[model samples]
Target: MASIKAQAHHQRVRIRGYDVDIRTYGAGARNVVLVHGIGASGRYFSRLVDLLAQTCTVHTLEMPGFGSAPKPSHSLDMAGFAAVNCDALRAAGIGPAQWVGHSMGCQVVTEMALLAPDLVTSVVLLSPTINRGERNAVLQGLRLAQDCLREPPAVNWMLLTDYLRAGPRWYLRTMPKMVRHRLEQRIGGVEVPVTLIRGGRDPIVPARWLQELAAARPGAVAVELPGQPHVCMFTEPARTAALLREAASGQ
Candidate 1:
């Protein structure tokens, strides 16, 4: 997820006693749902939403304990996160949508399809986190630090603000859950269409892992945004939205 200022309709939806904040944009025929990664709120996706809102009704969610949503009594693992999100969307009368996620959000959407298959028409994973080769926390942290050097100052600042909101405690409690989830193994089994996108300069989601994820599904599409960093959706909104729009069209 990345940040930019834009106007959107905000609504609050509660599921399992958790109040989730959702931002809706556009009035197009197709619906797209954007999910943010660990320690990120929907705000990081503001820029991309502006581009996507042009041709698709886009919804951005702030899951409990992350983003603007209040912290839960306990940190939720990937499955719990998916369950709440799935029910929230269904409650909002949004379903069978193009579910797109970035980083850990990708794992959440994968679990979403598994938990509520009918709710997701397709999945687009952008810069998916916890690459198989760098599952350890230290390695992941090092990679993130390395990736930060590639990101512009603005993008890094936005990510820092979001991370601060999440706080160290909740983030640490949730980190293992993200590292442990077998997204690479689980995504291949999803019944719906799957697409994988990564920045050519992304250290988190390696080129080899992207290829492996693509190979998992017979018709899966793997795309690389050359010269883009991990948070390309923010800096390269138009191009990112184009790929997302294509996926939403069932292409």
Candidate 2:
């Protein structure tokens, strides 16, 4: 189990007429923003937040329809979701922070970097999802199941619980958008530094795809955690947090 930090707290703020929930931790000079994947909430980043909070101010978002954030009147597409998060960040007085995202969260942050370059210092994509080559939902599900088999039971539980909390209807509604976004095109437009972190055993995000994603962008860096599974950040918070700190510091 990961150590719990006493400093973590939740903040509710409205952005673009939608209520956004942010979990904040630590109070260091640097700012780090965490974006959770589809069917997930800020709670998914609990361990990572606790670790990073030790050295940097960290803000993890519950992207509108997920976690405790109220469900919107209508579902927002990938870009729309990213835009809302951008507004939430600005409203919270954050500017140019290191953006760290997990799974589908990577698409959200990547879209944010493209839409509002000045607001992002850098980007970290952890076990990024929806590989363009295998966008079919059935195929993705199979790969996810395969990856889950390798991940620890705790990580699988965390994922299942978060997915249930996100609700099946909303997750299904958001699936197409996540699959259709052209990450290759979008990533090409991001000028800030980008880092790709993936578990060596992540079936959803294969090593080849990670390499391809990094290659698509001029200076993007790809880091793989050998023997790790899809939810590497959740299972290896200390090591992952240190890598994030290094990426944030450009080390």
Candidate 3:
């Protein structure tokens, strides 16, 4: 994986009334767009992009408020985010490209597919958090309690700051909207080939959800990375890139 600073064509492009930061690498004929999860930026896909660039052109998007990008004045919801991506793709001259999204980005990609199915050739979802209602509340409670007791000072401090930025009020307001945004409903409507990626060790999004999602779609395929966690893209870049390439090639 190439470092973010080392990518030659790294630059910011204006899209959907926002300044979107994008990195383009390789000269392959097919174009692939990568989207990152919440509180993260395109840099998260640096390693995967470096590997996939060898076989296809790769474009990583830095959404508003993440990475070095500025936050928008208006609220950043899933639909708005998807529209921004659609506009960005059109502005960048990328058409009918394979959309690869991780976590929250997966929701965004699903929304985009719903809005403009023709603009997306296929989708590759990594650790998709679709059915929040089915999440293990007891496990979440245990993890919270454990983190409160054993987290290191530096890590705890960072967590505190993040919580402050993402205040209780903000979380309360945002979660309901996010929870109600149904990806499963959209999945059934997506006409393109869909591939779901799950981490074997992921606690957030269970393997069952992926299985159910794959089964809901006629030709969808699901792949699980053994011993990997929620951040499987980083932990299994080679495998993730392979899946992305397969989706891009329509194989």
Candidate 4:
């Protein structure tokens, strides 16, 4: 949870046209949007927004089926998520802004860049998951399914209380769609400047994938946090904010 001071400085905006719930902070000319990963919400970027607000106007978006927004009625996939984000950005009057996404948010950012390249100035991907490969990808999906099945309802309650708040059935039904999403092709099509941040200790996404993405992009840089994990954005908001500032400034 973010401090009271941080939340006080941020403004909540509802964009009905896009069906988005957005948090806006600071008054800087440079605008930046933060997108959280699966089973998370805009609240995850509270600290990062606090840090970046000094030099950038930060916007954090809660997807249709997450955070305070209503659960999506239609079948939701990466593309659907991207479209909603795009509509939200437009409704919020954000144009050609720097986009920062973490984990599953990275995938959404990729899809947005592909879907509306002209609207994106640059992208910062945190712990992006790409190229799952044939064998390992299937195994990972199966493992996630098994874990979902084997874990006690209490464990699920403890870990995903926020998600449950959005809607248990919605979360359960959307879980499989997220696991099956593949963004390799869309990621390869990105032409804007990209900076990838990876937690060295993150087990979910390997360093090899980060390296590959960096190699593929025309102007992509990958940075690995020395002793961080999947939640590095929350665990290391200051460091992540610095990287985001650098990328936003075109450094």
Candidate 5:
């Protein structure tokens, strides 16, 4: 099933001045952490949340400056963001499970795996963004605009709401930090198992980048879901959840 009417228990964790909002679902043994991309909230992955809830406990995190989490005093670099987020999650007793991230969230979790190695046992990167080949604001914006033409209305609406909530100042302030990170280079530093996934139709993350990332890591798994957009987890929650379930199974 692509979705289910699962109940989410919301809670806020305050760690080292960072307020983290987490929505918990399911009571299964396997645990999965869902981290949304830049300018997005946990709601972006609601479909996947519900689907995964059926078979595993899902922790949907709203990072600082987006969603329910309060904005920070200043924009943080990838490493800084990773430290704050991982500290909060670890404080909340979450870790040693599959840490899945999308867009810039992918960079954050990968950094977390390196900084707080104990908190992340495995990492799943979905449509990781700011391709080193096209890392400028103009190019990134153009790619996003192009992808919008193919996105479903619901997906666009969700993004609209989340973007508004994040506000332009914060989003712009963090944009450069995201573009500056070298995810392809950092992925190599991650000691834990890593899985790379992307929607086949995603323009922001090209297939060549995914292949390059996989090639650099001998054991990494790369998957491409046909006919899906950047937010494939929302469009094909059941299919993505199956991939996640397989990832979590090894944990």
Candidate 6:
């Protein structure tokens, strides 16, 4: 992938009564949408965006209640979150493209694909969350802490600061929907191709969970990058970008 030479286009558009910030990178024919997790902003995909911009137009969506976006009047469930993103993309004059998401963002994209299949060409989920076997928030938090030990300081710092930026009120209010979302069941509804990528050492999404996720769809493919933790997109951008490229290429 070529280094990102083009400047990104940053703008805020209204979506469901809230101003949603979205960044567009490159002017390539193919469209690639990047969705951050619950606590993270679209900025988390800076490196991956640079890589994907080489051959695809990358769109980073900063969901309402996260990043610099203002919180909504009330918490939105998974479907509501997807609807907001879909509406934002449409309002921005962007059409269907490859969808890439990290952690809770995976749930969001999966929901989007289900809600607007015509708007999603494919999907790539990184470190997807709320493993069916371990859906409780407390246990997942403990597992995330354990996984953090293996992550680099910069990765943990980014995660911590992003979580702080999101604030407890919003995170706590929105987390239940993420945990309760039937992502495993919902994945089956996505007719477009799906690719599931997990850090080999990611505690939040284990091997069995990845397998089950892949098994949910007849054409889904699961990839594991050993020794990488939950935020591999930050710590291992090259590998993550390469996998994303392959997924976007439909390889």
lDDT of 4 by residue, 21-116 (tens): 777777788888888766668765666777878777778888877777766557568777888889778766787788888877998898898888
For candidate 4, list the clashing residue pairs, or say none.
Answer: none
lDDT of candidate 2 over 147-173, digit per residue (tens):
889978777887799888878998889
Mind giving the per-residue lDDT tens digits that candidate 1 earns over 1-251? 22323457788898878878998888888889999999888877878888777778899999888888888787789999999999899889996789999999999999998889888888999998778888999899999999999998988988899999989998999999999998878887888888899999998889999998888777998999998899979878889888887886783
Query: Native-vs-model 4 lDDT?
Result: 0.73
Backbone clashes, candidate 6: 0
Q: Give the C-alpha miss distance for residue 55 in model 2, angstroms.
A: 0.8
Name every residue pair that clashes in candidate 5: none
lDDT of 2 at 200: 82
Each prediction's TM-score versus the true structure: 0.95, 0.95, 0.82, 0.82, 0.95, 0.95
RMSD of each: 2.1, 1.7, 4.2, 4.5, 1.9, 2.0
Model 6: lDDT of residue 171: 95
lDDT of each: 0.87, 0.84, 0.72, 0.73, 0.85, 0.86
In model 2, the worst 10-residue window by lDDT is 1-10
Q: Candidate 1 — which residues are off by over 4 angstroms?
A: 1-7
Report the CA-based lDDT of candidate 2 relative to the real structure.
0.84
After TM-score superposition, what is the CA distance of residue 81 in candidate 2 from its true location, in Å? 0.6
Over 1-251, each residue of candidate 5 has an lDDT whose tens digit, in order, gives: 23343467788887667778988888888788888889999887888887778778889888888997999787788888888888878787886678999988998888888898777767889998767789899999999988898889988998999999999999999999999998878888888788899999999999998898887666889999998889988888888888877766564
